[model samples]
Target chain A: MSRLDDALREALRREEPPEGFAGRVMARIEARKERAGAWDGLMAAWRGPRLRWAGALAGAVLLIGTAAYQETQRAEGEQAKRQVMLALRITGAKLDLARARIQRVGYGLGDR
Target chain B: MRIAIVVLAATLGTAWAQDIKMPPAFDKLAAKAEESVDVTLDSGMLQLGGKFLSDKDADEAKAKKLIGGLKGIYVRSFEFAKEGEYSAADVDALRSQLQPPVWSRVVGVTSKKGGEITEVYFKTSNGAQIGGLVVIDAEPKELTVVSISGAISPEDLADLGGQFGIPKVELPKSKGKEAK
Candidate 1:
């Protein structure tokens, strides 16, 4: 029992720490604080209004680009439709003129 | 060498199938014309234009239906300030391409008083169905050549003429009537 008590006393004795031990512990705590601060800063930036504004701006740009593309396509389609109508008009007029002339010439069926 | 020749022959044979090879003189005429219109719509453009056409509108709906089966529509028209901006040789060059066995002259009319000549040709496939149509209208002051390729029937032609304020001509339904 005495031997166990001596061992316990030696193990639990309050002795002065080694040189710079407190300084090293304090330095390690400061480093941990700095790491936490950097992570918080990054999170704060993500949660800030600047990021929201940037996202909104990107969305607006995408929407405007899509609208502009559709408008250009519509304009091209309108032009193509007009040209098609004109071509068909000219073709029909020519055919009609030829038919009239053929009827006048007494070539009834226009087989030639 | 044999494969190369076969490939080239196949390419040329496909080109000569239905489409008309416009003469180079058309470019010269276009440059000299007071007003010119050149519309070249391949199948892609036609399909795109057809998409934009409104089905509710009668004219657009009719046009959409007409262009549905068409592969291409090429029209070149020029109006000159003077009467002799183009020569007969230019017209003849285009006419020479419309040879027989594939193309047949269906209608030809010459008006001396009006100084106009109009010829219509049909491209027949499999000796039965009309695969294409070409119309050449040459006037004293204007010239227009229209070539439409792909499947088109005589009824479709009549419908096209009937629409767009053009008077409709009665075409005989029977192939026997068209036999020359």
Candidate 2:
């Protein structure tokens, strides 16, 4: 669309890497692989029994914490159940009293 | 003196015993409830709804038996990270369900504070009471719907609070456990 754009496009043309680029890339990749392998071997050797024991201890603590949480939930549920039963019992008793009062009133009216 | 105290406690405990024996099935149903809702079906009319919290340890057979006694159970819940996620269209959809031959809308109350609309409906069959429905629109907080069926006294409905476990009345204390 413009002469400036055409000149810029001509100035910048696509080109391949140098002839030894492929070989240089392969050499770098091999070096990285060797370094990674050695690092992994070193890490495995450094991981002693103490580290394993620490991991296991942490896991056990987590398990115990989970169990305690579950027990607390269970206890709360039981307490709620007890409260509900008590309330229901009270309501039933009140209804009974109301019924009795009504019956007494009816009997008194009959006597009159 | 201890014997007298024990006798008095026994007497009080016997008097405090519940008269109405709610069916065992109802007990199981109450146990399953997680959250209980209370709303006035109409201005001065009351209704209650309970949401049961499902549990893996729950007895399936017993829960089923308890649910079977219930005439109607309806639930409508919305989850939003922020407020104002719902529109009037959502409420209208629910209102439409309460329309027609089944229910007659009695009153509609709207609140300016929360933009909440409470619509009450009464259901009848041959001019006799059957059921009632209540739709509440509360924004930025919560929304609730309560559907009540069977012959529930209006007075009893008004007494219901958030606690769904059971009703409490003054009762005599028990003494037999103390002796043991």
What DockQ, between 0 and 1, does each candidate earn?
0.23, 0.01
Q: Give candidate 2's TM-score.
A: 0.32
Encode model 1's per-residue lDDT on A1-112: one tens digit a residue. Answer: 6999999999999989999999999999999999999989988987897789989999999999999999999988888888778878888877777766666666644355
TM-score of each: 0.77, 0.32
Model 1 chain B: which ten-residue window has the lowest total lDDT?
A: B171-180
lDDT of each residue in B69-147, candidate 1, tens digit only = 8899999999999998999999999998887756889888888898899899988776454789899999999999999
The CAPRI quality class of candidate 2 comes to: incorrect
The all-Cα superposition gives candidate 1 an RMSD in Å to the true structure of: 7.5
Q: For residues B1-180, write the lDDT of model 2, one tens digit per residue.
A: 999989977764543331111123322323333433321121111111111223343332222222322344333334445555555655665565564455566535455675655454555445333344343434454444444443333334233321233333222233211110
TM-score of chain A of each: 0.59, 0.50
lDDT tens digits, residue span A1-112, model 2: 7999999898888778989999999999999999999998887766776679889989999999999987776665444333332332333333333222323323211121
